[model samples]
Target: MTILLFGITKDIVGQPTLSLSHSEAQGLHTAGELKEFLKDNYPDMKKLSSLAVAVNSEYAQDEHAIKEEDEIAIIPPVSGG
Candidate 1:
Protein backbone atom coordinates (compact mmCIF):
# COMPACT_ATOMS: atom_id res chain seq x y z
CA MET A 1 0.00 0.00 0.00
CA THR A 2 1.05 3.56 -0.74
CA ILE A 3 0.52 6.37 1.70
CA LEU A 4 0.73 10.00 0.63
CA LEU A 5 2.01 12.48 3.15
CA PHE A 6 1.24 16.19 3.36
CA GLY A 7 2.41 19.20 5.38
CA ILE A 8 4.03 18.23 8.65
CA THR A 9 3.48 14.59 7.95
CA LYS A 10 5.64 14.88 4.87
CA ASP A 11 8.31 16.61 6.89
CA ILE A 12 8.25 13.94 9.54
CA VAL A 13 8.47 11.14 7.06
CA GLY A 14 11.05 13.05 5.04
CA GLN A 15 9.18 12.29 1.87
CA PRO A 16 5.97 12.88 -0.03
CA THR A 17 5.00 9.26 -0.13
CA LEU A 18 5.64 5.91 1.59
CA SER A 19 5.11 2.40 0.35
CA LEU A 20 4.36 -0.63 2.48
CA SER A 21 4.77 -4.20 1.37
CA HIS A 22 1.79 -6.50 1.32
CA SER A 23 3.06 -8.36 4.35
CA GLU A 24 3.50 -5.11 6.22
CA ALA A 25 -0.06 -4.02 5.56
CA GLN A 26 -1.63 -7.43 5.63
CA GLY A 27 -2.71 -7.19 9.26
CA LEU A 28 -3.83 -3.63 8.96
CA HIS A 29 -7.43 -4.01 7.91
CA THR A 30 -8.79 -0.84 9.53
CA ALA A 31 -7.74 2.78 9.75
CA GLY A 32 -7.03 2.29 13.45
CA GLU A 33 -4.68 -0.54 12.69
CA LEU A 34 -2.96 1.53 10.10
CA LYS A 35 -2.49 4.30 12.63
CA GLU A 36 -0.97 1.92 15.13
CA PHE A 37 1.31 0.47 12.50
CA LEU A 38 2.52 3.89 11.48
CA LYS A 39 3.00 5.04 15.01
CA ASP A 40 4.97 1.93 15.85
CA ASN A 41 7.17 2.08 12.79
CA TYR A 42 7.47 5.81 12.47
CA PRO A 43 7.75 7.29 15.89
CA ASP A 44 7.86 10.83 14.54
CA MET A 45 4.32 10.44 13.27
CA LYS A 46 3.10 10.35 16.85
CA LYS A 47 4.21 13.93 17.34
CA LEU A 48 1.43 15.31 15.21
CA SER A 49 -1.27 17.00 17.24
CA SER A 50 -3.88 15.68 14.86
CA LEU A 51 -3.62 13.32 11.97
CA ALA A 52 -6.43 12.65 9.56
CA VAL A 53 -6.54 9.58 7.42
CA ALA A 54 -8.11 9.98 4.03
CA VAL A 55 -9.12 7.13 1.82
CA ASN A 56 -10.10 7.81 -1.75
CA SER A 57 -10.13 11.50 -0.97
CA GLU A 58 -12.59 11.25 1.88
CA TYR A 59 -11.75 11.59 5.54
CA ALA A 60 -11.89 8.13 7.06
CA GLN A 61 -12.78 7.03 10.56
CA ASP A 62 -11.05 4.44 12.73
CA GLU A 63 -13.42 1.74 11.59
CA HIS A 64 -12.86 2.44 7.89
CA ALA A 65 -11.55 -0.56 6.03
CA ILE A 66 -8.30 -0.29 4.12
CA LYS A 67 -8.00 -1.92 0.76
CA GLU A 68 -4.87 -2.58 -1.24
CA GLU A 69 -6.10 -0.58 -4.21
CA ASP A 70 -7.42 2.36 -2.25
CA GLU A 71 -5.68 5.70 -2.34
CA ILE A 72 -4.63 6.73 1.16
CA ALA A 73 -3.10 9.92 2.48
CA ILE A 74 -2.09 11.36 5.84
CA ILE A 75 -3.19 14.91 6.55
CA PRO A 76 -1.62 16.60 9.53
CA PRO A 77 -3.01 19.67 11.19
CA VAL A 78 -2.36 22.85 9.22
CA SER A 79 -2.57 26.52 10.08
CA GLY A 80 -2.17 29.66 8.08
CA GLY A 81 -2.72 33.30 8.66
Candidate 2:
Protein backbone atom coordinates (compact mmCIF):
# COMPACT_ATOMS: atom_id res chain seq x y z
CA MET A 1 0.00 0.00 0.00
CA THR A 2 1.16 3.53 -0.82
CA ILE A 3 -0.01 6.60 1.08
CA LEU A 4 0.39 10.26 0.24
CA LEU A 5 -0.08 13.25 2.46
CA PHE A 6 -0.69 16.74 1.14
CA GLY A 7 -0.45 20.27 2.58
CA ILE A 8 -0.25 20.26 6.35
CA THR A 9 -0.53 16.54 6.36
CA LYS A 10 2.88 16.40 4.75
CA ASP A 11 4.22 18.51 7.55
CA ILE A 12 2.82 16.13 10.11
CA VAL A 13 4.18 13.01 8.49
CA GLY A 14 7.41 14.75 7.45
CA GLN A 15 7.02 13.42 3.96
CA PRO A 16 4.75 13.72 0.95
CA THR A 17 4.16 10.04 0.50
CA LEU A 18 4.98 6.71 2.03
CA SER A 19 5.40 3.49 0.22
CA LEU A 20 4.06 0.84 2.53
CA SER A 21 5.15 -2.60 1.60
CA HIS A 22 2.89 -5.59 2.04
CA SER A 23 4.64 -6.42 5.27
CA GLU A 24 4.42 -2.81 6.36
CA ALA A 25 0.70 -2.56 5.58
CA GLN A 26 -0.16 -5.70 7.41
CA GLY A 27 -3.67 -6.15 8.79
CA LEU A 28 -4.98 -3.25 6.70
CA HIS A 29 -7.91 -3.74 4.35
CA THR A 30 -10.13 -0.65 4.17
CA ALA A 31 -10.05 3.11 4.49
CA GLY A 32 -11.23 2.77 8.09
CA GLU A 33 -8.47 0.31 8.70
CA LEU A 34 -5.98 2.78 7.23
CA LYS A 35 -7.13 5.46 9.67
CA GLU A 36 -6.78 3.07 12.56
CA PHE A 37 -3.38 2.05 11.34
CA LEU A 38 -2.27 5.69 11.22
CA LYS A 39 -3.76 6.38 14.64
CA ASP A 40 -1.90 3.46 16.11
CA ASN A 41 1.29 4.18 14.25
CA TYR A 42 1.47 7.88 14.91
CA PRO A 43 0.23 8.93 18.30
CA ASP A 44 0.07 12.57 17.26
CA MET A 45 -2.72 11.92 14.76
CA LYS A 46 -4.78 10.07 17.33
CA LYS A 47 -6.09 13.31 18.75
CA LEU A 48 -7.32 14.69 15.45
CA SER A 49 -11.10 15.02 15.36
CA SER A 50 -11.50 14.57 11.63
CA LEU A 51 -9.64 13.87 8.43
CA ALA A 52 -10.30 12.83 4.87
CA VAL A 53 -8.90 10.03 2.74
CA ALA A 54 -8.83 9.38 -0.96
CA VAL A 55 -8.20 6.13 -2.70
CA ASN A 56 -6.92 5.94 -6.24
CA SER A 57 -7.53 9.64 -6.89
CA GLU A 58 -11.10 9.54 -5.58
CA TYR A 59 -12.62 10.35 -2.21
CA ALA A 60 -12.87 7.33 -0.04
CA GLN A 61 -15.78 6.67 2.25
CA ASP A 62 -15.59 4.49 5.32
CA GLU A 63 -16.95 1.58 3.35
CA HIS A 64 -14.33 1.91 0.61
CA ALA A 65 -12.07 -1.09 0.43
CA ILE A 66 -8.30 -0.76 0.14
CA LYS A 67 -5.94 -2.79 -1.97
CA GLU A 68 -2.23 -3.43 -1.84
CA GLU A 69 -1.66 -1.50 -5.06
CA ASP A 70 -4.00 1.37 -4.27
CA GLU A 71 -2.63 4.88 -3.95
CA ILE A 72 -4.12 6.58 -0.94
CA ALA A 73 -3.82 10.14 0.23
CA ILE A 74 -4.56 11.69 3.60
CA ILE A 75 -6.11 15.13 3.45
CA PRO A 76 -6.42 17.69 6.17
CA PRO A 77 -8.64 20.70 6.35
CA VAL A 78 -7.08 24.03 5.49
CA SER A 79 -7.83 27.71 5.72
CA GLY A 80 -5.79 30.08 3.61
CA GLY A 81 -6.22 33.17 1.49
Candidate that scores best on lDDT: 1
TM-score: model 2 vs. ground truth = 0.88
Q: Cα RMSDs of all predictions?
A: 1.0, 1.3
- Which stretch of 10 consecutive residues in model 1 shows the poorest summed lDDT? 41-50
lDDT of 1: 0.88
lDDT of 1 by residue, 1-81 (tens): 999999887887788999989988788899878888888888988777678999999999989999988899998878977
How does candidate 2 score on lDDT?
0.83
- Model 2 spans > 4 angstroms off: none
Provide the TM-score for each candidate, comma-separated. Answer: 0.92, 0.88
